[model samples]
Target: MGGTRVRTRYGRFGGALAAVVAVLATLAPVSPPAHAAPAPSVAPDPFFTYAGSTPLRELAPGTVLKTRTLPYRVAGVPLPLRVVQIVFRTTDQQGRAVAGVTSVIKPLTGTTSRVISYQSFYDSLDPEHGPSRAIAGSTAPGAMAAHVETVLMAAFLLRGYAIVMADTEGPTADFAAGPEYGRVTLDSIRAALRTPATGIAPAAKVGLVGYSGGAIATNWAAVLAPSYAPDVDRRLVGAAEGGVLVRPAANLRYVDGSRIWAGVIPMAVVGVARGFGIDLMPYLSDEGRRIYARLEKAPIIEVLGAYPGLTWADLTQPAYADPASIPAFVRTVNQLNLGTRPNPTVPMFIGQGTGGQLEGTRGDRPGLGKGDGVMLAGDVRSLARKYCAGGVDVVHREYPLSHFTSVPLWLPDAIAWLGARFAGRPAPDNCASIPAGNPLTPLAPAR
Candidate 1:
């Protein structure tokens, strides 16, 4: 009788627990299995190619070459959202027509009237590492940056803002080629507006947002839009960027021998050569040549800190030790310098950091002053001041943070600033108080 009672009590308790679970299951449906399927291969996808009968040069910039829709995924895990990918014709750094790809992610609510051109800082020398591949479920190391950016993209999406992520590096992944980045970005927005699948109106008011490498694209797009794509420019609300690259030549000098950012020296070398179709191989030292060959197809993840204390002298032949001595480099970097370009017409919000020591980069460098590890804060200030002087509204902020850490602080303020712009608020400007910064003179070839 005792055993029977014990069994009966336990059975009743089990039945009650089962009933509770059933009710809870009804309230919250079960999600898909947590284990994601195998990631797609890292090999280049042929869909990126523009195989149409007409040459790319024959097509107008922003002309749509191809369009497809795919499920949005983050690091190989599929999300409920779907994204539209567009292949568009855009100009390269050398002014040649090239193919570019951009991914348009709509909010779950399906509102597409407001859009943000969220440039991805997926800095890589490999085209396969572009954002489109990551969105399509590739788990490659190079594509990881794009995968990580999906979280930030989701923030905009949650706010009922559609995000257009251009592979700003272009089809060839010309990392750090700022002009090409701008061209690709503007063209991507053009393509997104033209695509019916994206549901973005042709007259959608667009704002640009990016940090680090993305800032290169954001600022350039703003600068070039007035002439390169006036139709897109007129619709611009404003631009928000952090860690701006004002003058590439100064940056090259600033980051030389940096413990963390020195690797960017060779990456930029490879990217500039690829973007401009210039052959710099003859000027490289044997060690430089080996480093270049090894990093020709590397991503920024594999680069940072890989070559601590590397410098231009270490990378060039003895006679070409000074980068300015290389005629091609002088011409290319000057072209890449934001200071040489016309000021952007749109109101701008620029954020810069000055705590480079935290990232192993020294704060004291003659003429360069303090920087945010990779980008010089003073350079950013100079660019902002230049924009302000040109009658553009500018709001500049500085933080005692390194390049990576500054993002967390900059992002929230950037989003709020952009929101204010969209709401027709008067853009803010601190031009009168902005301190003088480093000179942004273009580099001249060494005599």
Candidate 2:
């Protein structure tokens, strides 16, 4: 939170990725409502009317319509900066908003691209646990928003694209975890369309970009889109996810030992434990519980460095000591098998950190024979091929960057590809033909 305000509103609670599960469980009341209560309006969003423009506007080229608030609601509090909408006027060799570009690009090929949003969560030490949603940046004034404005939104706006960042923590202030991400992402996109400024062609192409926790929303959206938003006229062109942090159990184990991941463990443990009504403080020595709570919302790397000699077994309770009452809770954890799911109707960009693997970390687990760190990029691609057997566009790209870098590098390309598909470009067999297990290496960055 101390760093420059480049953090995107989208990543306001990045630290909560570890703590959200625990926090949500503790905070959400029994029989809580589906959505969070509404928030009161505070300062007027500047982008609400840029240059006297609407949410959907014709702005001067290169003039970023800054800090436009997408109408969003969180339980009881109307977060002033839930989703940041930035509009870039397309330009030529010389910067210009490229008037009439909308019309020229219009009739939008009648292709539909709906949003498939994913949310990140702390690993479930217990398979029966639900995810946490402590709203990391939400409680911290301006911290959450700065992340979105500086990191995520600016990236998209600079590229002449519009961005919708969702504060998916929802109404109860209990983090709904993965499922909520997909719901909120899809809903937010719909909200964007309905917003006065979005002016998205009714059938405009929609693409998803998320990393770490975001991958949860993106992944679920891809799988659920066909069934959920079928009537929206979407082509479901593509999705790109990096540092997936899939296989919740395994991921939990991987980071437990590492100093890098240790900082956020308390938060993750509390989040996951809360789902099962398991409070870690009761289980651990008072000193341990206090240490865990203090480190709960911090980053993982910081955790491990602080407490040396930690392991997965030490942090988590025995699996299945008590059976789960809720079917959703069981499914969220035990059923989090990534390889079995099929690909969407479009191409996919899956990335992994050199140190991270589907098995959760760089170690070897029995069923996950491939070294834990072995990238799942290949596995996801293969799954896509099988699902789209007759025909599907599945491309796998692996970057040299670790989990964090993967998203930003491939995001623009994925968007461009989605744009081409929306423009009536054919889905490619080349993706299918690309050799299996080969990392879809990125093109060298332009000088």
Candidate 3:
């Protein structure tokens, strides 16, 4: 379903949005008051914890847990912040801490603008296939957890913000897609609120941000907001998704023989099927099963070039031969193409980058609609207009950059847009009634 125009890798960190703040604090000398006694020497306790009988089940060994205070200046007014460590489970199945993979609690910060806001990030991981049926030494079970440490830590830290990246896929490395993703996202936010440091107002506001697979979580989080976490005082605010995979079925079809994604589809299939207890061998031919089983754990891009000897005609043959036998495949793909309707809880900010090719084809297409089918500017504009008409504050922007190039540019704007909502700004007008042209173009305020 996708192709990369540029190939650049990013790094992951263990709570280093910047250099260690405590270390910096220690290095800087402090002038004691004339009447003050000497400061006490203390040992460092990095684990962020609580003294309660009702223990949260997710906390595990080798995970670094700590609180981060986020301060942002708005119109010269200083804003106090609290980002507590709720719970972050490590991805190691040996029950040991794995380096560079973790999840934390993101808190609710009350806004001087009267809109309370909270944010979190979920990154993807890669699952591996081993020699035996009972695999061992697995670090993280799914792609959602695979490379997340690099993507999320870089994105959140640079913005002067802290995020709770929950390894919600559980200890078995289960990547709970769709509705399951929504549950974990909301529960983590709730857990963050319950942490003592958050100082949550009863009327605190909330919003979401995610990219690619993470966008799947963000989209469902927005849809489930009204029903699931109503007490959290959340509004959609705005959501900026990059290369969103909304239509799972369409994505599967596109990636079957597509360059750079051949491995991705099969990996997702085996991983998801295993998670759901579906056996794929019955649906695949002996040769098809053999190839899929071997390449299931391979990295996405690496898998594509492995089969170059095969023709496009060979790749599309399996799909055309049998459709009924792959019910799980059908269900999995169908989940990707979500329906069109406003979240009703808050406005949205949707965006797409021109860097990745969708459906194994590339071109500048207008009137491209939202969901997983196509990544066209025109469809995005049309969706933006619809959200605007329903009294949702919808803002759509297209950059000249590719998928990865636009992340840095999009992060700040996404954060600020949600920040405005947390500040209690009124949602912008509905776009449903707006003309298709310039749907994302900001209009002049009525005099």
Candidate 4:
């Protein structure tokens, strides 16, 4: 609560405890170099469109198959730094080994033992909007959102940390598939550390940091590491995430009638359906199908705040009126739920924004704990405490501001927390001090 009050009142990017390098991110003007016009967008190669001969069935999940040089860019301009791309093996939710790519940004000078797998919150169902396009200077709306991470990535680079940006969505661009996100992230780390050109040592220390949609990937990666990617798990010192979506079912309920966030319903539905290979047409009402079709290829930036007061009732058939009643959605969302998963073995830094009402609410119901504009703060707190109970080192912070303000404010702490982990200092455990958060419960089946 003390930490919550501190962040609530003054959510500045660099607080009084600003590190030297973190402050450089704000002071040193970005220096992106000149580059030729972007390559013609010839139906840009889709992620996971692998042409390799080895059947995916025979390879391990972290095998790196291909490599290429990437132009490091911020906005439309490329940076005069070495950037390498690695396409490696990863798994889908059902355990199929698929391919994933990671962008490795080598610092202009110096080497660090730590590698930061910075996940961008590029929330989109379209392939063009994935991280690869952003690296190539695609100006698509969703692709532009990828620049949001470049600023932070620059901070990591300035600190001499080799940066790894994974296309966590996988070949199909499974936007909200939490398990796929985890698998892709862990494998990307594997590809980064093992590849000789990346300059990452065999035992390079790793940490994760993300917000919003990226937070989903970061959290899933942390939980999945111990069981699915034990090699990566042993290397991860800590992870920092803010405004995470721990419970998709609860998020759907929280955003159902929200004035601005309600727009997320259709996007999430379509993404989840694609992630699980489930055709939702039968379950959707006429209006629902139309909405889903429209947003099937839409990006979060283009659609945000566009549709207010949307609801499942407005989209789905009356028979499939209740979202939980739809068996496919219920099952898939349960798989995506982070609360039902194992605790991360490494230390965690989880932050929440508790000002949900900042954004308009069409007919918002109570019970979903105070959220940022989109995610529930109470749910984030619950996940943090659960981590504590499971004996993981946990650092939970809360802010009174809305989601937008919370993102920038939490970075200082995130950077500092991750730094502490890499420094081998013990993270302060809040297990005893943290009051009980919401119960870590799975979504119930429909009657």
The lDDT of each candidate is 0.86, 0.41, 0.42, 0.78
Candidate 4: where is the Cα deviation over 4 Å? Answer: 1-42, 46-48, 361-364
**Model 1 TM-score relative to the real fold:** 0.90
Per-model TM-score on C-alpha atoms = 0.90, 0.56, 0.59, 0.88
Model 3 ranges with Cα > 4 A deviation: 1-102, 105-162, 168-176, 197-203, 233-238, 286-288, 294-325, 340-344, 355-390, 429-447
**lDDT per residue as tens, model 4, 105-210:** 7754445588999887888888777776777666565675555576665566666789888888887778789888988999999988888888787768999888
Off by over 4 Å in 2: 1-160, 171-176, 232-235, 263-265, 273-288, 295-309, 316-332, 340-343, 355-391, 405-408, 429-447
What is candidate 1's lDDT per residue for 121-175, written digit by digit as tens? 8889988888898888776767767655656555566666788998999888898
Residue 367, candidate 2: alpha-carbon lDDT: 33
lDDT of 3: 0.42
Using lDDT as the measure, the top candidate is 1
Over 4 Å off, model 1: 1-41
Tell me, by TM-score, which candidate is best. 1
Full-model lDDT, candidate 2: 0.41
Query: Could you tell me which 10 consecutive residues in candidate 1 have the lowest summed lDDT?
Result: 27-36
> By TM-score, is 1 or 2 better?
1
In the range 336-416, model 3's lDDT, one tens digit per residue, is: 334443354567766665554533323433323322222344445555565565556676666655445566676666666
Q: In model 4, what are the clashing residue pairs, if there are any? A: none
